[model samples]
Target: MKDRGHVSTTQTLDLNDAGKIIDAGIAEAERIGNPSNIAGVDAGGCLLAFARMDDAWRGSVDIAISKAWTARAFDVETKALAKLAQPGADFYGIHASNDGKVMIFAGGVPIKEGETVIGAVGVSGGTGKQDQGVAEAAAQAFARG
Candidate 1:
């Protein structure tokens, strides 16, 4: 018998799997010709691995990681959060206090396994749509396994 709210579940991505996710993100970025910065983080919002492609903006590396952290911590697309942060929103300044580490943009997505969110992926240095596309590709790669 399990206690209510204490159900045991398995982790979607282990340390080894996290490495695979990073590799998938890199490959997807190359495929898209974006060559941007990509980052993957665990449920705890800790960075698992990251990469900055050639010609990528140096600052995008940090931005990608921050976006991943925000998505994982909040369990929603960073872009959606950005929408809520628009002028006159009740939580506008809330997302801004992360010290430039929380990017509420369209480049972050939560990694999920059968309805359980286990991590998040973020990409930057490209257009907002391009970033989201790359992140989605990476997430799909993980999901296929």
Candidate 2:
């Protein structure tokens, strides 16, 4: 019988990892002067940890969760997904799907282990660019550790 390769191990994030991501995001958001809501999700697209900075917009909490879920669900940066989800694009109207849990905008970044997406980080409460910057920093910190 022919042998198959060993089953690949899955990468998962724990609460500690989530804390790291959230801390990095908070740091970036503070530096940018954009108090923000940040979220982290595990490989299964389940919420792991979340943080809302003081004075952050209350409305952004849901946005942050949705963004994280969307990133892990689709395994792509939401900023890049925004383009695909644009009118006349492949993913047009996607935001209207997923029971409205899809956030087709910046601020969501998938955390990867090699070529595999293990989790995601999301931020909200500022301009799209500011949120995106915070999310990226959060994910990068996880990637480095």
Candidate 3:
């Protein structure tokens, strides 16, 4: 029997937290002089918040969201997945799975709490390094807060 005094439920990332992450990502993008599309996803890989900087590539919108979804879906950084998805690697051809939603590249970062992934952030519309930097900044800011 459940304890009446203790309510139990799985923790999930909320929109307020997601907004903070997105703001951090946007700030990083601006610092780097790169307009970008940023996306945040909940633990269940659902979109919680997003932002598109002015002059950002329109095509990157979907890419950013997919990157966030891919991160939360696999609980792995998309950049790391890129390496594994390389030719002849274990995850090779994985990009072809998930209905092409898997983005095996930089810019996706999973936010975790004690080994459990709570959510993720993704950025696009710049070089892989730039996107990675923004995503990392967002995750780091969240961790610090």
51-134 per-residue lDDT for model 2 (tens digits): 999999999999999999999999989999999998899999999897999999999999998898989998999999999999
How does residue 132 of candidate 3 score in lDDT? Answer: 96
For candidate 2, which ten residues in a row score worst on lDDT?
1-10
**Model 1 residue 113 lDDT?**
88
Off by over 4 Å in 1: 1-12
Candidate 1 global lDDT: 0.82
Between prediction 1 and prediction 3, which has the larger TM-score? 3
List candidate 2 segments past 4 Å from native: 1-9
Backbone clashes in candidate 3 total 0
What is the lDDT for 109 in model 3?
96
Model 3 poorest 10 in a row by lDDT = 2-11
2 Cα displacement, candidate 3 (Å): 5.9
Candidate 2 global CA lDDT score:
0.94
Top-scoring candidate (lDDT):
2
Candidate 3 on 68-121: residue-level lDDT in tens? 999999999999999999999999999899899999999999998768799999
TM-scores for all predictions:
0.85, 0.93, 0.93
